[model samples]
Target: MAGLISKVFKAKWLLLGIALVLLLVWILRPFLDVFVYGIFVYYITRPIKQWLSRYIKNEGILVSVSLLMLALPLIILIAYTLLVGMSQLMAVVNSYGLTAALPSGPLTNMTTSFSQLHSNLTSGNFTLESVTDITRQDWYKTISGYSGNLPLLQAIAFSTGSTIVDIAFKLFIIFLVGFYMLKEDAHMQRWFAGTFPKLMDEHNRLLPRYASAVDADLQKLFFGNLLSIVFFAIIAAVVFEGLSIFAPVPSLQIPSPILLGILCGVSALIPIVGMWLVAGPLFLYLLISSLIAGTLFTHFGYFLFMVLAIFVFVLTIPSFVIQPFMARGQVHSGLLMFAYVLGPLVFGISGLFLGAIVLVLVTHYFGIVVPEMAAEGQESHDFDL
Candidate 1:
């Protein structure tokens, strides 16, 4: 009768816990992005928080100093770099007369010109050289003329303003939540441990060990990935800059070396495909340009060769050589790769971290927690016998 009553009491608490969890999830659904980002920020700044804690006893002061000294500056630097890279990329697009082709006026004119060119080609009267000349003169002029319109500028300004506001609001919420989380990290952990039922004594005892394993894996994944990004970005920029300076064909130079490098770095974060995201588009652009101009086939060939070389040296080599060393046995390479790839697809950008966390927790429960519980049960059975 006592055992039956205890089981019933536990069931009642379990149902209450489930209901509370559902309520909390519903309430937090709107701010999920902010909370997810806050967790990421907390993980990234955890080491700083620990280090600062040694010198400062007050958690509030330590978190504030860490945020100001580390997080704020990092955010500002990233924002500045992005703005500069975008400006440089826009300048390159403008220089190439690409943006001019985007407006309706220029697109309509290009369509008319293309129809005439197609008709001439079908008649066999227009040679490739004549077609090239027409493209150089008519296409260039039409694209260049479209750039002076006022509506395009106004549209761009409005879009930029709205994007900035959205980004700022998100950042504010992330930092706010992250600051509090960091300040109360220990208390949160204690509360979480206490929430588990007494029936889960073994699990409660093993919780710290499980948490430590998760933290180690997360640290390795985050820091190793960060290093990989920086390494690829710098290598890509240097390789492209070298090609611009030394390549035999000046016309085949990478248009925006810095911007391309930044993009390559961002692409490097994507698992499996990696830097190919940037290199593939560049290859296509050069191929099309060479075919259209007809005179730069050799230049395009050399440019393509250089791009492949950069991919091999900067991207492929490091994935094998540097990443293993950085990972330090904290997490399986295949699993981390899967988490990086599938996380964003399922959960948006925050999925990257969340997926890894879920994987780690599941692995820990099965590998450590379950086995330990079974061994304890066996011991208890032996003692009863």
Candidate 2:
């Protein structure tokens, strides 16, 4: 009776534990993005934090300097660079006189509507009422203008917690998660290893090897991203410097090519940034200038630049080729590129990092664990033979 009761009690507790985990998951479903990003931040900064421990005496100061002091400025610089690059692209398009050449059609109406909205936003006279009123009018005009085209516009989708306060709160949570993770990095590692002691037993040591392999690959994946950015910076410098040699005008010659190259390379890693950046904007301006001066065909530089820019940025070498090369083949370049590309398409923005993560674990298992297991099997077979 006693043994039966013990078994029943154990089963009851197991069910209760499962229930609690489900409850927690439901509660955290909405804020999953915050936790995911926080974890990503922790992993990316882990190596630098470890390196800083030799010099910094205090844990608090080390974490702050590594994250807030250093990473913050880099983030801001990337953001600023992306904005500047976009503005230059817009300038190039405008210089083509596209707006002036446009007919008064649906596209023209949409452009005018957006222009008016921008003016209102920047005019400092924007109010809730004024903005809503403008939106309503513009919506009506846009709908009417496109009424004959398609009834494809059915619904507008929106996310919850889109207000400023909600955004700030989410950021705060992300920072809190990151801070604690960094502060307790050693503790977490110990906990992780201790959590599955059976797997770490002396006979096989499977868990230890698995964990070590996973950690090593993750470091390679994250640091590989950084190294790729540096590599891209070097390429950007070479390409821009070469382009400068044949430039007849200052506008065509990129100013501060080195700084701009670094910015472009870094910005490419950011999810929302589609920054061909230094090369894209420069090549655009050069093409337009060359065409306006009727030197596009005569100027060999223009043709060469077109080919170079198209080859480097448009042909998809950075994410596909350089990334895997820098990663040292722990992860395939094509697989990583697809993970970055399709993750967002299939699972939304958070999927970008999440996909890389899943790819890492899957690759580690097949690439490292399976091979090791096979090698051990071969050794045993040879010994028996």
Give the winner by lDDT: 1
Q: Can you write out model 2's per-residue Cα lDDT over 1-385, one digit (the tens) per residue?
A: 9999989787997789899999999999988877866776676677778889899989999997778754455434533433333333334446677655533332223333333333334454334665546777776774465553232211101122245577678768877887888899789878877886776664377667777877777667655674466457556655666666667655456655544565556555544343455456666777787678777767666668655774666326766777554553377655776675455434544555677788888988887678778988899999999
Whole-model alpha-carbon lDDT for candidate 2: 0.61
- In model 1, the number of clashes is 0
Instruction: Please provide TM-scores, in order, for all candidate models, with all chains considered together.
Output: 0.56, 0.57
How many collisions between residues are there in candidate 2? 0
lDDT of 1 by residue, 73-148 (tens): 6555544444444445445656688856433322233223333333334454334565545766776775465544
The CA lDDT of each predicted structure is 0.65, 0.61
Off by over 4 Å in 1: 1-14, 52-58, 72-167, 193-204, 234-251, 254-325, 328-330, 373-385
Clashing pairs in 2: none
In Å, residue 66's CA in model 1 sits off its true spot by: 1.6
